[model samples]
Target: MERPQNMSIAPRIAVGVIILFHAVGLVGLSLPATRPLFLQVVPWHLLLMLLTIVFGHYKLSGRFKAFILVVFWLGFFAEWIGVHKGWLFGNYAYGTTLGVKMFDIPLMIGVNWFLLVYSAGVTMQRSGLKNGFVRVVTGAGLLVLLDVLIEPVAIKFNYWQWIAGSIPLKNYACWFLVGAVMLYVFELFNFKKQGIAAPALLITEFVFFGALNLVIGLWPL
Candidate 1:
């Protein structure tokens, strides 16, 4: 069956609710009185965000499921190596604010990688960019850009810490490389694009983190 051009009301409402919830949460986080309570909710927030993306891809084909699995594992492994060996993403380590972890990498990192690549890939596809290489590269670029926004906020929120009190260039380089490969795999799988959740979540994250970065001004920089 062909995908609908517009998202259905159910998914749209879900996305709207998530956005509103996060927007309010961010506001709460900005105040010292609510900051602790907001930090405690960070893990659940990440889980809910991942759930929104999954809901967007509901009823998708097995190929898409396989794609998500591969991306998730690859992302986890990359982070595992980065945290232990300091290879892919430079010498950085996650903090407790993100909640539970395995192998010193927060489980949410894997989910985040999948969500970012999927959202970026769908966005490129929606942009009417027909060339596979262009789509992959552009999507990866977008991922890197998002990371630029997230890095500072991450540090400020104690989600992760960098070795030298600054984000390393290699970290962004790794993001671009891995993001490109993941988006390429997304193109290879040819997953059908449906609903507004992907783009909405992506844009929401961008604005959310971007605003945080602006307001916080890169702490410890």
Candidate 2:
């Protein structure tokens, strides 16, 4: 039996920061004056999220390190191909709001991908689901739904622009495909199902984007 005295406080701390930052971000981005400043912090927000999830894991073994590298580079390259070749998520271009660019894609975009996919993986992993395929599909579905909410907010904030100002069905479909592939990578790894931080982050992501959609829809800012 584990003792409460031995419990790590890192997950709790991470969760608190996740909630605090996202709440601040949502409010800051909703207003006219603070929007740009908040948007500038978006990459740092992503990095913070990545760090929290990394901290939640606590024990970084070789395979786990491999998982991080694979996801980061794979996500970066996928976006590279998607942006330059217009293959993966359709014809959308990133904006300057996300920060510095490599091949016109923000370096932090990979961090964004890792954050989304990892949280989805952890959420589904703890969902009491028994099959790998089901977890992958469900997690991917969750991300697609979040993307539906995110598209408008992303566009309004200039995170990325869809070609001709129209988002395609192709984008959502590819989000599912790519998300599932990443979740599949997650499943192949064996990590302890001990942290609420990932699930909290995932739920907070939905809340952040969903709340922004509602706020933006009402106010048009």
Candidate 3:
């Protein structure tokens, strides 16, 4: 999706909320005093972000809606395989922080996947890159970069834990491959210029995790 030209108030509001939430989240997560409360609301925060992205734009096209369903299941199933068989992502088990699990995997994993892939798609789509495959590859690479920032913090915060007690190289490799597959599917669709919410969310995620990683660096490993 592309950023809508002449964006209305909703997109601006969405952007504001994105910045506000991440800033608050940064403060909340970094400080020991507020960490537990913020951690408990992680799932709700995700839902709110989804709402902000969805409602910030007009009604979705049928194709885009279909795309959403496909990506959600793709993400969940991929995670299922990873969690159960140690195939896709790695041998990592989720903790309670992300909330309710299905088949021992958090349902929110799919939502997280959709949000990240959608945001990455929109961010790339808005770019000047004219090649579809290149965009997909670049977006996949972008996700891998974000994952680099997210992994250690995620492990520290109990989002998921590696079975081996250390992140493996295969984890990042699989992330790029799985992310590329999803992004390739994203490229198959022709979505309209929607709103700024997608890219804003993506950037906010990077900032949020990036800050967390920096803060976590201060702790003894």
Give the winner by TM-score: 2
lDDT of 2 by residue, 1-221 (tens): 22224234467787899999999988898889888788889888888888777867746568777998889988899899889999888998999888899999999988888888888998998899999999999999999999999899889889999887899998999999989988998988866675778889989999999999999889986
Clashes of each: 0, 0, 0
The TM-scores of all predictions, comma-separated, are 0.91, 0.94, 0.93
Each prediction's whole-model lDDT (CA): 0.82, 0.86, 0.87
Q: Model 3 off-target regions past 4 Å?
A: 1-9, 219-221
Candidate 1 regions exceeding 4 Å error are 1-9, 218-221
- Give candidate 2's error at residue 185 in angstroms: 0.7
Q: What does candidate 3's lDDT look like per residue over 1-221, in tens digits?
A: 45454433467788999999999999999998889999999999989887777666556567767887899899999999999998777788999999999999898888899999999988899887999999999999999999999998989989999999999989899999989999998888867656778899999999999988888888532
The candidate 2 region of ten consecutive residues with least summed lDDT is 1-10
